[model samples]
Target: MLRVENLVRRFGGITATDNLSLDVARGELHAIIGPNGAGKTTLISQLTGQLLPNSGAIRFAGREITTMPSYKRSALGLARSFQITSLLTDFTALDNVALAVQAHDGHSFYFWGSARNEKHLREAARSALARVGLGHRADVVVSELSHGEQRELELAVALATKPQLLLLDEPMAGLGITESARMVKLLQELRQEVTIVLVEHDMDAVFALADRITVLVYGRVIASGAPSAIRQNEEVRRAYLGDQHAVTDHA
Candidate 1:
């Protein structure tokens, strides 16, 4: 459903993404793993139109979206959750998601009515919250939410867009063990409904959830295969997974 071909992004003397190429089939959970500075976030930025590539192409479904603006990309059924929480601190969780639903519906100008009073937008937002297991917290202020709840809220906000492809950037980051497990479960559930491109540092979660894994080192893809193959790849072992293994063993 998504295709990236020979994508490159450079900043002066440094290359962030170097000729990276990959495809994500419909309903597949594709994970990208790499050491720090491997250009994972850069690749995402290019794909989501937050950063235009210096060269190469990105196609979603069938059409090329390399130069499409970020809002246009979002309108075309692509959604992303950032590594950092991007919720509005003062807004209620439901209000934040309702605004997202309203934005997609092209009705952002409606200012007077409580966004919560718009039944369709409210229902849509509530459903998104329920999907992320946050229905009960819908009325709570984002600032009052725990870190894990905030992460879930991020996913809920993304889902409010009804995206066909979900780009997740380290959904498990900054969570406690139980919270991480909860996120893994939520992501596993989401896989049944949408295609995912996961950029994660949690190897166990990646191995458990990814239908396929791509390994990146120094802004280049060094390996791409199934979980088992990725686990055994020498280059991956030498670059990232070896460190992952050591951490796992010590833990």
Candidate 2:
């Protein structure tokens, strides 16, 4: 569903994304794994239009979107959840999701005084919340939710847009063991609904959920294949996996 070809993005002398390229097939959970400074996040930023590439091409669902604005990319069925939580702290979880729904529907934020009063918006928001297991906490303010709950809420916010491709940047960033397990389960279920591109530091979760793994080093793909193959890749191990990551049943 997504294709990146020889993409390059440089911050002066530092090339964050150096001729990076990859493809994500429809309905697959493609995981991007690498050590720190490997440019995974930079690549995602380019995909979402938060940063423009110095050169190369990006295509989504067959169309060129390398230069499309972030909002335009979102409108074309692409949604992203940040590495850090992005939410309206003072608002209710339902309100935050409803706002996402409102925005995706092309309803100007100023059109209605609030998204809460709109029945359609509320219903959509509720559905998104339920998908991410946040329905019961819909009325709770974002600031009051637990860290895991906040992460779940962020997923709900993205899902509220009805995206076809979900770009997740380290969804398990700060979660504990149990919370990380829950997120792995959630992503397992979600992958059935939408194509996902996951950038995660949690090797366990990555091995558990990724249909295919792509390993990056110095902003370039060193290895890209099935989980089983990736685990045995010497180059991948030398570059990033090191001696820490253990073999999972996936191999």
Candidate 3:
């Protein structure tokens, strides 16, 4: 469903995405794993149009979107959640999700007042929140929710767009063990419904949820295959997995 070819992005003298090429099939959950400064986020930024690539191409569902703006990409069925929580601190969870729905429908900013009262928007937001296990906390202010809950809310907002591909950057970054497990479970269920490109530090989650794993090092692909193949790859182990081997041993 998604294809990238020879994508390169640079910052001054540093190469952040060095000729990275990858493919994500329809309905597949592809995980991107790498150590810090490995350029995973840079690749994602280029794919999502947050940062235009210095060169190369990105195509989704058969059309090139390399130069599409972020909002246009979102409109074209691509959505992403940041590594850090991005939410309106003062807004209730439902309100935040409702805004996402409004944006997806291309409603003007001036329509928000009436949009909030629209039953369809509220219902859609509520359904998205419920999908992310936040239905009961809809009225809670984002600032009042726990970090894990906030993270889930982020997913809800992304889902409110009804994206065909979901790009999640470290959804488990700051969660507790139980919360991480919950996110994993939610993702496991979600993979059945949509294509996902997960960039995460949690090996357990990557091994548990990814249909295929792609390891990146210094903006280039080091390995790409099924989870088992990635776990067994010597280059992957040495370059990223290190000596833990938990990707194979535990999962």
Compose the digit string of candidate 2's lDDT tens values, residues 128-193: 999999899999999999999999999999999999999999999989999999999999999999
lDDT of 1 by residue, 20-99 (tens): 99989999999999988999988988889999999999999999999999999999999999978888889899999999
User: What digit string (tens of lDDT, one per residue) describes model 3 on residues 133-233?
Assistant: 99999999999999999999999999999999999999999999999999999999999998999999998898889989999999989889998888889
Q: What is the clash count of model 2? A: 0
CA lDDT, every model vs. true structure:
0.90, 0.93, 0.92
By lDDT, the better pick of 1 and 2 is 2
Better of 1 and 2 by TM-score: 2
Q: Model 1 off-target regions past 4 Å?
A: 110-114, 243-251
lDDT of 2 at 99: 95
User: Per lDDT, what order, best first?
Assistant: 2, 3, 1
